[model samples]
Target: MWNPHAYLAFADERGRPYFDLLSRVGADAPRRVADLGCGPGNLTATLAQRWPQARIEALDSSPEMVLAARDRGIDANVGDVGDWVPKPDTDVVISNATLHWVPDHPRLLIRWAEQLPARSWIAMQVPGNFDAPSHRTVGELARRDRWAERLRDFRFRESPVKGPLEYADLLADAGCAVDAWETTYVHVLTGEDPVLNWIAGTALRPVRSRLTRAEWEEFRTELIPLLDTAYPRRKDGMTFFPFRRIFVVAQVN
Candidate 1:
């Protein structure tokens, strides 16, 4: 179970990229919009502000997230994107900092594209930091140490962000107008192990979910040396973590 409280730690760092992705949406007067994997609905609420004329639906698979969203008076529901059936009326579908959790995301993209009406937009952003020092170090620890056997069933860390041309081609093949790009965000963090702290908020959820408290602690402990080596502490006690993410915006024809 992923804890929303734990994930909220890096809200500032993650929120910037989300806003950048949303800016790409550029919805002038979208009628109906849906936010996929809208955890806690903090970012989803912005869609309502951006397109005040649109009725927004916030969908997330986690009960906790759905409940939080509902408490905020947003039209929130618990539903898996894998099983979600987008309405034909959905004019804009915005998914930020999500999608990576779903396996077979390319298929989902095609399906969402097909579900929307002509000129309907789909804007999404996903972290592509699997190759970053933080992720690579943690992955090495998860696969190389004594706990490796226990974590064998866990999926290895994969880039949440797909290649630009790959995404463009997928949308084009699905008969949609596609614009896709990749960017590396230089996130400056204070204190020690900020990169590790950031991943613990986002990418670490999957690995942590499968392990016991003791095992999780052990894994983090073992991974520390690797993190420090990869992200050497600076004289100012801060670190600059370069995180890459994929952003895509498509309009169905």
Candidate 2:
């Protein structure tokens, strides 16, 4: 359901969380690296640059994404991150902005932490924005009037992304040195309906994929104005979108 072009439209902003997650990963000179949910492979290419000699690999669920990434000289395969199991030689594993879609991903992390070899690391980041108005409005509107029944089968907005403490304890209990924290980035966006444009690339994807062209446009009509009120344009005509994300980096102890 991911359109590579649409997802990459706000590439810089979407890439921020990936870079932030990578910045905290302390693994060095890894023998092998695996990037889970490596969408479009733009950020995964950086890992290749950082460790040219390492056996670097990437996986994503979307064939289109894998194809796009391969075009960028990144070796990516279409595979669900949920079914991924690190090889014994994998020294560094990373998943950014993609785990929330997998049910019980925290448990998945714990299992990986328990099984990884010494000196190995697992780092992940997921958007912690279910409670934000951008998301609330979308869920709210979907449950009203003629849309509720239509959208009944498309519900998945409230993801199971956990808090900093939950992740901290999860990895620590699994015997890894953990660093977990949250960051709310207030991105100043320009252009018309900037907030809508931002989520259109991400949070709005499920709804967009399920709705017809006419239905999507109608939904957009309701969504954009609500987003305008939720994230009012500043005097300089830029919309400030506050995005919160949670990051955890775990190195096997």
Candidate 3:
């Protein structure tokens, strides 16, 4: 039920962290590259451009995203990223802003690090914004009134991506050389209720898909004002959305 258009509305802003994650990958030349959770494949296509000499492919669990990616001429498949296995000669595995959605990602990262061939590279980026005001209010609001019953179980959506040091240690234990860090992107968003528009593409989807049309609109009415206050507009009417993300690049050796 992922709306590609909604996800891509903040394409430029959403893309910056991916690019930052990509830039940190140490492999100068790779023979095979895979982008896990390569939503819409727009960024994955860039991987082909960056390493035209390499074989590149993208994987997303959403059929809609996979179809859109294939339509754009990128080799994309609809498959769970968590279930992916690296090809024997796979040189690099780079995932951008996607690992957070995979349940128990830290355990998955450890297993991938242990299994991938020595000297191969694994680079990943995941949003670390669970406690941020934008997301906190969702859980807060879900606990009240009519929302409490229909949306009672909705709060488990908080991403399980761990802190930078934890990933660093896991990769190190798996005999890889790891570089892990955190970055907080303060995105200045414009247009009407841009923050709503932003999360609607992502974090809002769980509630959106489950709620009836009337319930969704009623929820939006209550949520909008909270978002407005949580993320105040500047004089120029731009909302600053501070998002934190964790990045890990491990070269198994």
Top model number, lDDT: 2
TM-score, each model? Answer: 0.94, 0.96, 0.96
- Each candidate's root-mean-square deviation in Å? 1.6, 1.2, 1.2
Report the candidate with higher TM-score, 1 versus 3: 3
Supply candidate 2's per-residue lDDT for 234: 87
How many clashes would you count in candidate 2? 0
**lDDT of candidate 3 over 1-253, digit per residue (tens):** 8878889888898899888887878787788898998888778889878888999968999999988889889889989988988888788998888887788777887888777777889999888898899898888888888798888778545657789999899889988998899999999999888888999888888888889999999999999999999999999888899999999999999
Model 3 stretches astray by more than 4 angstroms? 156-159
Per-residue alpha-carbon lDDT of candidate 2 for residues 1-253, written as tens digits (9 for 90 to 100)? 7788988888888888888888887777898899999889888899978888899879999998999999998889999888898888999999998889898898899889877889798989998889899888899888888688778865556657889999999889899999999999988889998888888877888888878999999999988888889899989888888999999999998
Name the TM-score of candidate 3. Answer: 0.96
Better of 2 and 3 by lDDT: 2
Which TM-score value belongs to model 2?
A: 0.96
lDDT score for residue 21 of model 3: 82
- For residues 1-253, what per-residue lDDT tens digits would candidate 1 score against the true structure? 5557766777777778788877777668988899998988777878777889888988998898888778778889888888887886789988887788888888999998877888889998887777777777777777886867877765656665578788999999999888889889887778766767777866777788888899888888877778778877789887877888888998899
